[model samples]
Target: MLRKHLLYLTSDHLFAYLWQAGSLTPGPVFGADAAGLRAFALWLADGDTAPACLLADLVEEEFQRQLMPHVGGHAGRQMRRRRLHQLYRDTPYRHASVQGRASGGRRDDRVLFCALTSPAIVNPWVAAIERQGVPLEGIYSASLLSGALIRKLALAQPHLLLVTQQAGGLRESYFEAGQLKFSRLLQTAGHDGMAAGIAGETERTRQFLASIRLLERGDLLHTVILAPAAELDALRPL
Candidate 1:
């Protein structure tokens, strides 16, 4: 059976990644984002060939996460927005922000409330996709995708960091109690030694986690590395 297409959008293009159940099909088209947009428009022109569920990753969106005491109902949402507003007060994209939450624990009092803003990047995409026949089921940040991998692996470490290479760079997402606490994307250079470059970034990420108190001094930070097997092998000895 054919799988639903997962679209991951960058500044100039969208990728249609085939995903069925929990697995993927290779050779995801690089131009699928633009193609999908056109197809969606055509589908709207008629009434056929519209996807019921579409998953998207907005790569250019910026993430700002804050911790807040657990509160319920509309008041909680308001407080979260207020905090988000304050956080982005100086940012140019303040008005074009999206918010989400990653719960720490069932009874945990603290929750990580996240805001992603990139009006220049997100607004156009939203405007393009809205009012179309497609459901446009969910929009997500690329960093958050690592959380799904952690869950799939059933990792139980309290302070774990997941490192994956994407778009010619290394993306790190730190998780605590299955919730994404922090993330960073580092650009790559000089691909002559890919392994060493990745290793350096990995160390930098570890220090960053410590500097931010996400990984405290004397804390054991379990790292989950995702890269080519050869690259991973070289990193293993570091």
Candidate 2:
């Protein structure tokens, strides 16, 4: 059985974990600094050749939804690439994916463009992996993963709001018909005002969605909160 490693990255730290025998062993947590990067490089050099999957839960991420004329084959790929570059020219972590076609008119393709805007937060860790010749499976965003979570949990709502608490903050990702439309992270202070914070943030998100017209007339927003049982207890009344 091949060994696998997982990396969870946030603004302040990068958590490393080793997966063996269906169990995950916690490894070192590296600070996002020069000295930490050096230590991470040394740690990777300890003869572990396992491939890694990096999951980033950073605040500095962007998402844009655009409609473009449907073009298939190689041209479509080039067009999406160019559009991604145009949307986020300065970031190398940009990606675009087609989320089906539009309803009417030209029936254009709906493309979601996203990027990890902070290179300083990610580049060093990625560079360290490259230097060590470790196979990087992929760099994934937590917001993007919420779409899959909704699907896995069988939340089949037309407009869904998925809220998850993470080390960095509270992540609220809005999805339309199972497609991720946008996401935002709020830096929460301790567990003091947890329920209130979630309520306030969730309302704010709804207003923002309406302002942007993501919510249509009489559209119901099904909210799914992913948290521990204790947190859920606190949120149940809200």
Candidate 3:
């Protein structure tokens, strides 16, 4: 085992993390207010004892600078930036802490940011990076990433796997087993955007489950929704 562990971090009212190679609870969710981001950055960067200035630059300049201004708000944008700044000041941009140690030995860590803005809001940031000749691994829809976690944990071993996605033009379910697999993307538009969206989506899920059940003549139930928290919670996979 090469031991690849994924660090999935979402920026929410509190940030949540899941470090998975193997473990239940996946990983515990942790809170990261303005002060916490620096500590987190240090952890992500591993302990290198770089000056606070350098670390802040790494975050603001490298990670958040582009995402900040485009957020567009006379009132909130400055405050968001200021809070992010304060996080930088609180400590070095990152540290390494896995077993409750202040820091040490974080040679391998991938820091993923769960951006709040939509692609339309954040995609332009990439242009600036490209202008500076910075390379990127790739970009993915946040909804897609969310859906992946469920499939990885629950469906990886199943003979037939299905997953649900609920974003504009991103509604879908997938199937796979052995070397066989294909994706089914559904352009399911609900009468009420995403609020009453679930009603229509749930109905579609029911049809999918019913059809699969009939085809297999056995329980082949499968589905996962990667939508807003409220929407995902309200939805019951059919």
lDDT of each: 0.60, 0.89, 0.35
How far in Å is the alpha carbon of 152 misplaced in model 2? 0.9
Model 3, residue 232: C-alpha shift (Å): 6.2
Sort order, lDDT high to low: 2, 1, 3
- Please give, for residues 1-238, the per-residue lDDT of candidate 3 as tens digits: 1222222322221222232345423323323354444444444445222211110000111122112222334654455545544544432222211111112354322221222322222323334334434333344433334335555655553433344443223334333331112233344453234434545654565566466542254545354444556565445442
Query: Candidate 1: misplaced stretches above 4 Å?
Result: 1-3, 18-48, 52-69, 88-108, 189-193
TM-score of each model, in listed order = 0.70, 0.95, 0.30
By TM-score, rank the candidates, best first: 2, 1, 3
Which sections of candidate 2 miss by over 4 Å? 21-23, 190-193
Best by lDDT: 2
Q: Write the per-residue lDDT of candidate 1 for residues 1-238, one digit (tens) a residue.
A: 4455455665445555556777765533443366656664554456433343333344344554544656778877687667766766543433222234444554424444444555554454454556664556566667666777888889879888887766535677788777777776666552336666766777887887788777877888787877776576677776
TM-score of model number 3: 0.30
Range of the 10 consecutive residues with the lowest summed lDDT in candidate 1: 90-99
Count of clashing pairs, candidate 3: 7
- Candidate 3: 10-residue stretch with minimal lDDT: 53-62
Better of 1 and 2 by TM-score: 2
